[model samples]
Target: MAEGLRTAYQLEEDDIATILPEEEDKFNGEEFNKQFLQFDRDRIQKINQKGKEKFEQGYSKAKKEVLDQLETEARERFGVEDDELRGIDLIDHIVEINSKKSKADPTKLTEEQIKSHPSVIKLLNEKEKSFKTREEELKTEYDTKLNNFQKERTFSAVEKKALAIFDKMNPVLSSDPERAANQKSILINDLKGLDYQEDGDTYIPLQEGKRLEDPHGNGVSFEKLVQSRAARYFDFKKAEERDTPPAGGGDGGATGFPKTEAEYAKIVNDQNIPLEERLEIKKKWNEAKSQS
Candidate 1:
């Protein structure tokens, strides 16, 4: 119940467990709580009220269904309309919405039948327009940002000297666009922080401290951080690629895909993997549904 309530209200269970109890014991209830801790009387009252309600309701089926849906949406973690999985649910959603009409129609409805339905077709067309508009927005924004960054000459010295060292050190970063961007950003920051001497067409890099902040803000060597994280991103990107199915639907062959929707749901709900990565896996999962 404690964990469930924490999740339902987006409370930090670890924060409460580690910090709240200690603070409670350390101070008297009559004394004012510290503002930084964010554990004021009203907050605690709200949590207690919700807990009382949940306890009285006893996790009813209606509440369970709502919670399940909220949990699923949270897991979906849908980002901007990437072209790859562009509105895969439009067909399913439309079919569900027009189930009665579909049943009464003489024509046998195929999985792709939504393509022919007037309403479905219209919605899809509009979504495509939206996709294009969003794409253009992204492109214009990216170009503007890139131009500004270039004009600033923020990384010119890094590009001159340490870029070669960075390339030699973090080659795995080149495999994916996101990884490449992250590596570039980190290396530029790392190099800029370093003390450098100007030479002919090159730079001599030095710094008093031997360590630069890792991308995660912990201390580590730039080479070490890039080597470790680059390898991880490479593996993750490769797995993402291998998992993506061809848009023509699942291949007319077996490929170790999840055999049932239940299995797919289990995988999709997995909180261990990154949410975006899990969503990509859900996109590629076979459409098989479990008997249960």
Candidate 2:
């Protein structure tokens, strides 16, 4: 009998365990197959309908929440009213309704309704103006305090200029001790005739040729003394050069530097080459000049 059943059904050994008599009833005929297919279709349709309904409900709730938040914010910030809010035409009503409420008529608006109505926008502008005015007042008060502080701690013109010179020189002095020393020597030689005073630790520049008695006045050389001060000024200039090195044209020939007459002038001026060399440079300048 088993051999006959196997021959008729063409079932394998694995299939035999799952093919129960009751289970076989559903697949035995075309009518049962049709009924099973219809049941599956009905189940799928029901599930889809339920999912769509839930999605629509959630979307509506979210939209309402967003609108509520926008309305609250607008009212607080700009004093916008409900009557001022008009529904935008071209924009999605859901998104527009969710946006900040403005003082405009929703019903009468045509294509592309203004996000914020004129009245609502004007109110917001007024609020911004008030904030800016307050900020300016605070700033003025702070500036006044700063000015008073500066006046209380003031330096003489010569002292101030000396400090400025020292600041300029400091960077150079820090970078190359040798170059700074050389510059200091040259400056002292140049300013030999100037009279200077020491305020605290700093030497202040004074009127030229005004001799003040030095405590160690054993025939002090005025030229040597002024030269020492000049060195500081020269060192500062050198330091500036070191800090901002020539851009481009390194050993690799990058050519990133500007190629123009104006740019050339800037480079030459910065290098501090002697006047004779500068004159010679102008002779060959056009030929060697880079095109802009």
Once fitted onto the true fold, the runs of candidate 2 whose alpha carbons sit more than 4 angstroms away are 1-27, 79-116, 119-292
Q: Per-prediction count of colliding residue pairs?
A: 0, 12
Q: Specify the poorest-scoring 10-residue window by lDDT in model 1.
A: 77-86
Task: Report the C-alpha displacement of residue 27, candidate 2, in angstroms.
Answer: 5.3
Name the lDDT of candidate 2. Answer: 0.44
In Å, residue 246's CA in model 2 sits off its true spot by 99
lDDT of each candidate versus the true structure: 0.46, 0.44
Q: RMSD, model 1, all Cα superposed?
A: 31.6
